[model samples]
Target chain A: MTTLCCGGCSWPIPVESWNREEGVRCPVCGEKIVALVFPAIARARSGAQPEGLVSETEASCFYHPGSRAVVPCDECGRFLCSLCEIEIDGRRLCPKCFENSLASNRLEAAETQRTMYDTIALALATFPLLLFWPAIIGAPAALYTVVRRWRAPLSILPRTRIRFYLAALFAAAELAGAGFILRAILRLPRVQ
Target chain B: MAKNKSIYRKLTPRRRGIGGFSQLWLASDHILLVRSSRFVEQYRRFALADIQAIVVTPLADHTPWQLAALGASIVWTLVFLVVDSTAGKIFFGATGAIAIGFSMADIALGRRCRCYLHTAVTRELLTPVSRLRSARAFLERIRPAIEAAQGTLSFDQIAAIAPAVTATPADAPPEVPQAPGYLPEALFGLFLVNAVFVLLMQRFPNELDNVLPTTFFGEFVILIFALARRGVRDPRRLVYALMVIALLFMSWDAVGLARSFTHYMGSVMEQSRRGRPAPPSLTGWVAFEHAPAVLAAGWRMVAGVAGLVAAWFERPVKTA
Candidate 1:
């Protein structure tokens, strides 16, 4: 039997093992306790072949040609041994492919940071309305923003194009209003 | 399921006095306290991991204040009846009924003592184990469970582990329970009552000569009791200090009530001798003898403001 520690406080729990269904309380911190059950890490030496390497007639590891190849890399199609093969999401990959895929995000394992143009466009078109003086400058800036990022990728989740449309409409309205104001200002001296 | 059943255990409550209306159920991860009274049935859960401390304080006895309020209200009703004022009768009767109702609530809802499950963010009342003996028993049953749940780690070790896990907001640990807003509620009620009493005193001085002190003293006792209850429920230094200040103010007012009344009567007699028409009905008398009623009002304002500040500091739990 292995000793169970609290998830909250890491206090040594006296219980034999955690029950999967419900959680317990940490006597020390009083946090709700749930056990994280994982297999013990193996202490065996790395790259130690269980059996003798295959001869020239049989398949050999791409990285270690003297060792036998167990699986092929899913991405690069290179032969890999037990030590050289990295398993992720049920797919085996060679060390170089694994390292490269993670670094370059070729595997699409995670999403990178992206600019949210729709948000920027919306902010440009609306925030300037607070200080009426900036509306003249903001109208053109908002218009330019929408046009530049029109074809850019949106958020990872599903969303409609309503925000883009709204931004464009507001920007157009501001520009028209600015024109109307300019025309009215020019006519004011003649009327007086 | 069998393993689940084995993990789930029942906590032995220290006290069992809700006429068998309260129960404690312990699952692998949480302890649930189910309390059912005639008016309400409340279920409270304490996560095993989040519990920082468990404490039981001595049971509260609200009898002295409850009886005081009851007596004063009854007296006020009699005085109103003797005066044959229909509005006065109704008003005083309502006050008396309210006082009785609160007393009854105190009897039904008030526990002998307070037992609480403490965490960093919240202090939860354990109604079942309110008695000293029962709370002890409850502690006995839950101690091993908590120790077992936690295994072994010091407070510092837990603190060190918290930052490592907060890299992803999605993976962030659950928010701790918030403190219940009972203290604020109590403080607000006390302040409101004081305000109303002050307004009434300003409007009707002669009629409320006896009434004001009686009701003020009565309400003071009740509010003090409420403050004491809150202190026991959640021990905080600020709350304790506020309670002490309120007590001192109340004592000062109680002692001065007799002298103020005597002075008021003396002034009224002197005005009669001089053949003055009498004080204006438009506004209550501001000065009662040599001592100004403004002094008493000032004291009340101080206390009310203090209560408000205390209430402000006592934050309630957020519910989503």
Candidate 2:
């Protein structure tokens, strides 16, 4: 069952009080927010164990030798009892395989933290340019970063490497300016 | 042994850390918010049965800030290239990076608004999870436990009894529509636009005269009218609104001061390195840059103090 909570405070909104579609003021915070309710099916319990294990009479679970095996894990092909069996995206997986799949993010729906290198590179290349002085060092740093992270994983959402290109271009410009300044400084004594 | 194990499992709240390093524990009967700093540890508990509502506020749009940061970085990078001072370039570069970093964080971060757990009597804050997906998942994990402890088939029983009206889509989840953002967000956006315009004008010495009018009007518009809008009808809301506006102005000015002050100090240091005595006349710049910030901070503090006083006076009405 889906629980609807007050938007102003996390208290469970009384189901009876909520209409199918309407705004309601949270009694606790007095903030108005809309609540929409929908139907849902219950998920079968993952940790349920078998009633009994029969030796020799039935194919037993790999983890629970006594409990009858319900299905074979799609990935590892291990026989699993009701407790060990996990169905994900229409594929039956044993507990260990399911966990591994989650860790590896083989399943697209798995939640995983990803490092955004493009943003970091852009920030590194751009911020130091603001003061005019840091860019001498920052430009090179940014260039190096762009090159290093060119193949790095980006945000989960689709993003282009336009930031990377921009960062590289700015860094190159900073480097060119720095070179020009160094040449002018060197030529000052020659003119003297 | 079995009883002890069951008691342990039921009593222990499912613990998880949210985006801001804040921890939340969902127990069999209550939710616990745990916040710890160097000096203090604070824990607040809201009983599951007592939780009257949960609010998910929508995140304010930050696209403008991201665009602004990106534009500023590119412009400053070119400016830094033209400027001969190495120290200045590096300083501005770092500052620009930080600005962009903040903007990016704001843009990339989850969109979940502040989540509050409200009881029958008082409202409590939960460590706001940034992503709606994460927040919803957290709620799903805790809902069954809360319902079981309450001993009422308040939520789940409805699914069983309520007809699965085929016309109603099977996968549709209930959602809370976003409320309008805080008024101060619009005010702050306006104030920042005005401030940026004035600062850009002040970049040139001859354009300095235009700065005063712009700054004056901007301040009056943001500070004066913000306070004026509340009017006299609801004194409590007026005080609250004033308090919020003051705090926003204070923080905004403080960040500006910090950035400007760093740049100013860097220029001074660069001059000293060139063996030239720092010009005393530049002292005017110090006051010019910082006076408003100091004033805003003072006003914010005063408003905060006054808010406490107002709250004291408001006790009777609140209870009533």
Instruction: Give the C-alpha miss distance for residue A116 in model 2, angstroms.
Output: 1.1
For each of the candidates, what fraction of the native contacts does it recover?
A: 0.00, 0.08
Which runs in model 2 stand beyond 4 Å of their true positions?
A1-3, A9-12, A24-33, A41-57, A87-92, A98-108, B1-320
Model 2: per-residue lDDT, tens digit, A10-35?
55554444432345555454554444
DockQ of 2: 0.04
TM-score of chain B of each: 0.35, 0.44
RMSD of each: 18.5, 17.2
Poorest stretch of ten by lDDT in candidate 1 chain A: A36-45
- Highest-DockQ candidate: 2
On residues A59-107, what C-alpha lDDT tens digit does candidate 1 reach at each position?
A: 8888887778888899889988887887664588887877887676454
Clashes of each: 28, 31
Under CAPRI classification, how is model 1 graded? incorrect
Best by lDDT: 1
